[model samples]
Target: MSTPTGFMEYKRQLPVDRDPIERVKDWEEFHKLLSEDELRTQGARCMDCGTPYCHTGIDMTGGTSGCPVHNLIPEWNNLVYRGLWREALERLHKTNNFPEFTGRICPAPCEGSCTVGLIDQPVTIKSIEQAIVDKGFEEGWIVPTPPEKRTGKRVAVVGSGPAGLAAAAQLNKAGHSVTVFERSDRIGGLLMYGIPSMKLDKKIVQRRVDLLAAEGVEFVTNTEIGKDIPAKQLVDEYDAVVLCGGATKPREFNIEGSNLKGVHYAMDFLTGTIKSLLDSNLEDGNYISAKDKHVIVIGGGDTGSDCVATSLRHGCRSVTQFGTHQKAPLTRDPINNPWPQFPNVYTLDYAQEEAKAIFGEDPREFSIMTTKFVGDDEGNLKELHTVQIQRKVDENGRKSYEPIPGTERVFKADMALIAIGFDGPEQTLAQQLGLETDRRSNVKAKYGQYRTNVDKVFAAGDMRRGQSLVVWAINEGREAAREVDKYLMGSTVLV
Candidate 1:
């Protein structure tokens, strides 16, 4: 346990982030690391509750309440508090294959379920996790450990995202010759292109990928199964195959003028920007430029916030985000959202914070729905028609939205991004393999078993489930690897 009276001595504190104005000027991570002494104090704040719900890894109220990867939160917190940084790193790596990734991008449901959070604030678990891994790297403690004995079995992972990467890492550790096939030009799938550099540095993703390669995980990029490489070839060539292809099919907004030139999906816009930045530092003229334009992002989720931030970096003249639902409360509603459940609270993300700092107002407009997109004769998006809506809850608690009459208005927009969400994994590969799909269009596989109808074929991550957090992907990937190992060797040693 952490210091018995530590919670009373220290309060929850996070490292100060770089100023929003300065951070928006470049595509680099904005958060600064805390001093070791300060971080140790933060770790000491962990109460080390008898029931550590922070690592419970369970679902509550239709959302995850704790660390999806089941990270040993208390163990690591105690280690860090005692100034045993290396031990903390070891405990962190036991469950999570990529603490660096989660520590950077995850929304930290673990903190929401923290025992201390029921009263005041939660321990800085996410920050401490990052600190441990980063310090391990800096101290030259983290190194590649290749498997000694080869099982002579071969495995193939379809995607290079978090799930696929986790599965590949675990399978390779179990002495199976692993080959990861990526459809994109780079090895890290969404990590390489989908997310912006400012949030998760591309170098950090590549660093881990390179380490995996050193540990003998072969990577083949720019190849797609069922297209460039046939599905039959992979099944026949490998003893087992794990499908981690994420849900890439973007949910479309079927409004008028959606096909206009200035209108694009959020992924396309984000991916293009990152790719261009990687290739020619934006000189290639490949990415959609939001510079000097009145940008309108349709959707108020994290993706929409990303669009707003990206547009701000591009020096957009004006920006606005529309949400279909009403804003959540600033604080948790105890009766509706009790303790140990993921809080449904209104908070500004990095992009929105930057937008607010620059524009002197939050960019989000809640309970507003876009009805149509208007464009000029040259096929350029120019305006958006939207309506304000009021939510109505019936006696049975079924809620619906009613558009208020005379609330329709036109807003000028030179560029519009659709940031709605995803439906499921791309169906091309699933159809080619004849894999069964759930009603939600996700690959049909039991959560723990992770096996498909086809033998030697398993699924995990966003492809198996629908869109989910990166931490959940890691969990699914690790679990799927255990099942795959059992199938391959008739028994397994994977955890």
Candidate 2:
């Protein structure tokens, strides 16, 4: 543990962003890393409590918190503070296969439980975490190491997202010949395209994909197993099949003019933008553009935030976000969300901050719903009709939302991006494979074990757990890998 008084001495110092105004001009990461000396000072602030919540990772639901992959937070922080960076890298790799991605974009829930945070600010754990992995790459410590021997067991992983990648990496380490099939044109599923290059650069994603390939994982892109190839073939050919496909089908709004032009699902806009960037040409009108238009994004999740940030980068004339729920409290409330649990409260994200900076006021409207979309004669959306509402959970545990009287209003918009979240994974592959899915459309797999109804077939990620953060996806992938490894080998040594 660092000195008790050190927490009081340190001011929770960290790096600063490169001017939000300048950053909004392009699709690039804004926050810069602190120097090694500065990182050490921040690391020294860790109290390393005897019952370290940061490492405990215990959530309210009996699930652990520190890290889903169980990265050694305390040990790595101490190693980093002592400048034992190589050792810190080793500790980080003990659990996570790709800290680089998580370090860049994860919400940093671990830092919230930092003992130092009880009084003053929390340690800059996320930035320090990012720095450790970055140093690992700079030192050329990250390289491909194919398993020493083949188990003669072939495994087919049905997704190229983080979950599939983690599963494949571990199964390969188990000496199984691993083959990953991606329906998209490129590997890395949502990582390759669903995420903006600014937040997660394509190069960073590709670097990991390349490493996996060199590690003897076969990647066959542009092949939808249910469409391009038969699902039965995967079962017959491979020793086992692991379904890591993500929940992709977007939840649609049941408002009027739902089929109008200039309206698109959030994934369509995000994925299309990435494809345009990949081709090095945004001139073909393939990418969704919000430039010179009033953009309205419905939903208050991270995806909606991304749409706002992306639209801002496209030079959108104006942007507004509408949320169905009332604004949450700024501070922790035990009755609503107990401490040590994720503080279910209101907070500002990067995009909202950027929007506030540009727009004179924050662009978010809480407890609001779009009544309908108004479109032009060209069948393109022109405006949105909205109303402020109150949401109350009923006795039966159902949610009911009703518009407040006299709160009706209309907002001008040329394009509307529905960011309400995902419904589930596309059903084509599941149906073709004859796998059973729950009513919510998620693949029916018992948590932790990840085995689907189909024999020797498993599911993970958003497909199994529904849409969630990349961190959770990593957790699902890692846990599923353990199960798959055990299923194949009858026992396993994987952590």
- The TM-scores, one per candidate, come to 0.98, 0.96
For residues 147-188, what per-residue lDDT tens digits would candidate 1 score against the true structure? 999999999999999999999999999999999999899988
Can you list the residue pairs that collide in candidate 1?
none
- Model 2, position 193, has a per-residue lDDT of 84
Each prediction's Cα lDDT score? 0.92, 0.85
Residue by residue across 1-495, what tens digits does model 2's lDDT show?
Answer: 655666888888868876767888877777789999999888888877787777554445423356666667878888888899999999998888889998988877787666666667777888988999999889998899999999899999999999999999988888889999998889998888888887888888999999999999999999988889898888999889999889988887878988889888998898988898788756667888999989999999889999998998889999999889778888767665554555556887888888888887778999998999888888989889888898888899888998888999998888999999989998977898788899999999998889988898999999998987787888888888889889988998678
For model 1, what is the error of residue 344's alpha carbon versus the real structure, in angstroms, after optimal superposition? 1.4
Model 2 clashing residue pairs (backbone): 57-64, 57-65, 57-66, 58-65
